[model samples]
Target: MAVTFYINLAYLLGAIAFVWGLRLLSTPDTARRGNILASIGMGLAIIAAMLAPLENTSNNYGWILGGMAVGAGIGWVSARRIQMTAMPQMVSMFNGLGGACAVVLALVEVFQFYGGERTLDSGQLVIVLSTLLIGGVAFTGSLLAFGKLQGLVRDNTLTLPKHNIINQIMLLVLIVMGVMLVIQGQEAGLTMAMIFTVLALIYGFSFVIPIGGADMPVVISLLNSFTGLSAAAAGLIYENNFMLVGGILVGASGTILTVLMCEAMNRSLLNVLIGGFGGGGGSAKGADGDQVAKEVSINDAAIQLYYSNSVMFVPGYGLAVAQAQKVCKEVDDLLEANGVDVKYAIHPVAGRMPGHMNVLLAEADVPYPKLLDLDDANSALPNTDMVVIVGANDVVNPAAYDDPGSPIYGMPVLNVWEAKNVIVLKRSMSTGYAGIQNPLFFHAKNRMLFGDAKDSLNKLVQELKNL
Candidate 1:
């Protein structure tokens, strides 16, 4: 009785922390502190779970503690050493591991229940089967996402014929197998569980392999929700309140993020799941008629910036690829020092993932107040004197605005073209992740400053200082 009280208190505190931490995470100012608070909450919940007394559950402290320690050490090292460019890959991998944990927990529950006195009730069957399936899909699916982001898997979308039909059939078969397993109960339980797990794993792989690289972030977020749902199911099996609450919180938040991102891209969740955007070889054409892009020298670009009253910097995946965020911030600081009004316009889905650019910029000590979201940025763009696009393509593409027939037609984009002057820093006239050619290059007032983003920014900075 006394032991149970301590467990309850820990779980209650942990749940409160998680909620408060998530609330704090809504803004940039306290996001780090929120993250730390949430981490502490999770730790408390874990320790409480370890101490709780549960029926038909193994308390292998040595094994559990050893696994926890190893995972912690590895995660700590990875966090310390991993670069910002690899953030998406790391996030995908971590989400995948969460799924794998749910899978293992489900397996342990089923395996130990063999020859037990009570048969699995309908509730247990639902919880256990759902956990296994969801967890299995999340594990391998996330790994595939990580592999694509890491360049181990091919970047392009690979689909077999009738892909949708094939998945439908597989899901049907899994359902039938699950129903049969539930009916057979303890008699054929062990064998069927293994078979079901294997099928789930295969489905998970097939599920993600056809998705294009550009859709990977959404896929990762969706898979994170899957992992959370699986964890919640695992909690039901273990009868742990902390586990249930934590899992529910994660699942709900991930689902919300995924939905918002899909809306931001002006695509349905179904369209996102069907994949085949981003990494495909295609570009959208629009109203901007000038095919010959105008080029501006570094000195000329610097002159434009120097004379401008206000400037907005737009960063994207190219900036990330060039590792130019720090240099980009340097340019911002230089302009601000020169009595120029400067702010950064960030798209909701800027770099490969949500908040990717924000993290990079924050690492350079960019002020939080200077960052603006889509609506606010768009409203400010028209009054802005100049817009310096740093390796951004799709998000600022006029194609999204003027071309109704374009793939990204309804997607929200930074209206940088509305600014008095537009200077694009790019290596070439290459298309972006959506595989869409930007019409912004040909806009009458636009000048393409073609070069490596970091090097170009360095030259522009030098030219400004000279002036």
Candidate 2:
């Protein structure tokens, strides 16, 4: 009785820690601390489980400890070594692993029940099947997403003729199989369950393959939610309170993030899922036919920045691709030193993932307060003396506002053109991920500084120092 009491007490404490940690994760400043607290909570839960009064749990401690050590070592190494650019893919992979774990747990439980004299109740069977189905989908879906983001798989939508019809048929079959398994009960359901799992895995791959690259942020979040719900189902099967609570929190958070991402792009969840939003690399002609963008030299750009009282920086995936966050920060520092009030204008869907630019800038030690969201940045742009666009294209395009027929018509974008003088540093006049030409380049206030982002920033820094 005493051991049981202590174990329950430990679980309660761990639950509190998880709640507190999740609350803290709401803000960027406390995100690291929140992650640590969550890790500690998980550790406490693991310890309590190992120390439970269940039969042979103590004897299995060696196996548990060995597994923990191996997992910790790999996680530590991966966390330290993975670059920020690949962070989204890493997140997808980890989420997939979580789902895979849930699937494995469900399978183990099924095997144990079948091999032994024990029989699973209808409720237990439902939970097991739920976990298996959801986990299977999340595992394969996330892997496909990771492959797309990593460039290992084609980022465009992959569809066969009448793919929608095929998908509908598969979904209906899966539902029918699940219903049949539930009706058949313990004696005759194992085969159905196995078939259900295979079908779920195929559905996952098919579900995500049709989504285009631009919709990945939303897809990733949705898959994360699926994984969390799967974990919750597994927890219900085992009656583990800690897993239940953790899964609920993750599910709720991921759902909210998915909604926010969809809103950022001014897209509906269904539209993203139906695919074909972001694909093709060909550029659209300018509204007034093809026009050459005016160019500016590094010295001239530096002179504009040096003279401006206030400057705003608009960064995009190009900055991340060039690994120029550090150099961008250096430029901010140099501008600040010369008495220019500097700030960053960040779009909600600026980069490939949510908070991608913010994470990169944070790693370069950029102050959190300097980062302004879309609305705030737009408000600041008109009053700013100069806007330095670093490897950004689609986010600053005036077409979002001016062109009613454009694909991204309703999407919010940085109002860099509102500033008095805009210097855009990019390698070329290529369209961004959306594959649309940016009319902002031809705007009277804008001057193109064509080059690699890092090199251009370095040159600007040298010019500033010389001045």
Candidate 3:
């Protein structure tokens, strides 16, 4: 008991460390050290959790230790091997694994209860229900998110014929099943458990499939929250304080991130939940804008940037894909040296995840003071002389301004068209994740400089240096 008290104290200190580390990570320069500190805190928490006694008589410490070793080995290999582009999918898979673990743990407890070896109580039953429901959703939802992000499956929003009605019915049935399981009174409860598990699996996939690809970052954060909540539920069932605290931290952080991301997109969480954007390959049919080829030369682009007094740099997934953040910074430097005031305009959903663009720019050693969020940047775009859009598409589209018929019409944009000159670096005129052409391409003020982002930026850097 004294040992358990000491472990609890250690766990509290570990939680403090985790929170402090995350605060440090919020700043770019300290992010790496923050990550390392958080990792150390997690290690300490794990040790304390392992030392706590299991409530059940069926103790298999050796099996638990073996499983932990195997999991750790796989995690090490995967993290070391995966590419940066695949990071989002890796995150999804990791979330799914956490959910799977919670589900299995809850199931084991339920099994022990039903086998007449352990008594079930109301508190434990609530924990089991919560874990099963949330973890079940997280597991299947995250798997689908992984497939979409990895391009293993089509990024199609697969909505039910009568989605609202169907969803309501499905949810109602699941709730009913959970209530029944809780009240089954110990008479052959295995069937009830199986039924609940199956319902949860179906609900999980169904929940994620209808969401479009453009809103993946929010969905990922939402699923992350679900996984954390599941872990907390499982912790309560097992009476583990560290698990509860850790899970609560994850849930709170993920929820905050999801809200921030939604705001960045000028969207509400309800809109994200009901609208379901970011499926990947396709979405529900919407207005397809006319495409026109309007191209320009690197020299023309350079002249515009060099002469402009104020320039807004808008970034997107393409910027990250090319790993051109450093070269981008170089361009910004050159533009600034020429007396052009430069500020980075970042969209909330820019890149693969929340804070993704910020992460990339931080990697390039861009100052946080120079980065502007959507609202702040949108206001400045009108007075700007040039808007240098690097591989961004739908986010800056003018169609969002006047075309009520367009899918993203009501969605707020960067107001780049308001600038005196818009210089866009692109490989091709392909539509963005929305699968619709951007009308901004045909705007008279916008000039498309066709090429790879890295090559184009490198050339621009060389041209600037020569000048």
Local accuracy of candidate 2 as per-residue lDDT tens digits, 1-467: 88888888888888899999999987679989998998899888888877775766347767778988998999899999998778889989998999899999988977776666567887787888889888998999999989988988875546766665777898899888777777777666566667888898888888888787777778888999999899889879878888898888888888999999889778889878874556655343364575778999988999999989999999888888889999989989999998999999988777777778888898999999999999999999999999988877777877777687677777788888788999988898777777788888888888999999999999988999999
Residue 36's lDDT within candidate 3 is 88
lDDT for each residue of candidate 3 in 1-467, tens digit (9 for 90 to 100): 88778788888888888888888898777888889888888888878776766565777888979988998999999989976667788889999989998999988987888888788876678788889999999999999989878876665446767675676688899888888777774773787887888889788888887677788889999999999999888879888776787788888999999988777666788777667554333322222445465787877778777888998899888887877889999999998898889999988787677777887788798999889988899888889998888878878877776776666767777888888888888888777876777777777888888889989999988877777
lDDT-sorted candidate list, best first: 1, 2, 3
Off by over 4 Å in 3: 54-65, 276-293, 336-339
TM-score of 1: 0.95
| Over 4 Å off, model 2 | 57-59, 281-288
Residue 238 in candidate 2 has what lDDT? Answer: 75
TM-score of 2: 0.95
lDDT of 1 by residue, 1-467 (tens): 88889899999999899999999998778999999998899889988887875653766888989988998999999999998889998998999999999999888878876557445786798788899999999999999988888878775445688886787798889999888777777776688879999999999988887777777768878998998899898989888888898889889988998998888889998888775677656657753464788999988889889888999999888888888988988888888888999999998787767688898888888899999989999999999999989888888987777777677888888989889999999898888777778888888889999889999999988998999
Residue 184 of model 3 has an lDDT of 71
lDDT of 1: 0.86
Error of 3 at 81 (Å): 3.3
Better of 1 and 3 by lDDT: 1
Please list the C-alpha lDDT of all candidates, in the order they appear: 0.86, 0.84, 0.82
lDDT of 1 at 447: 93
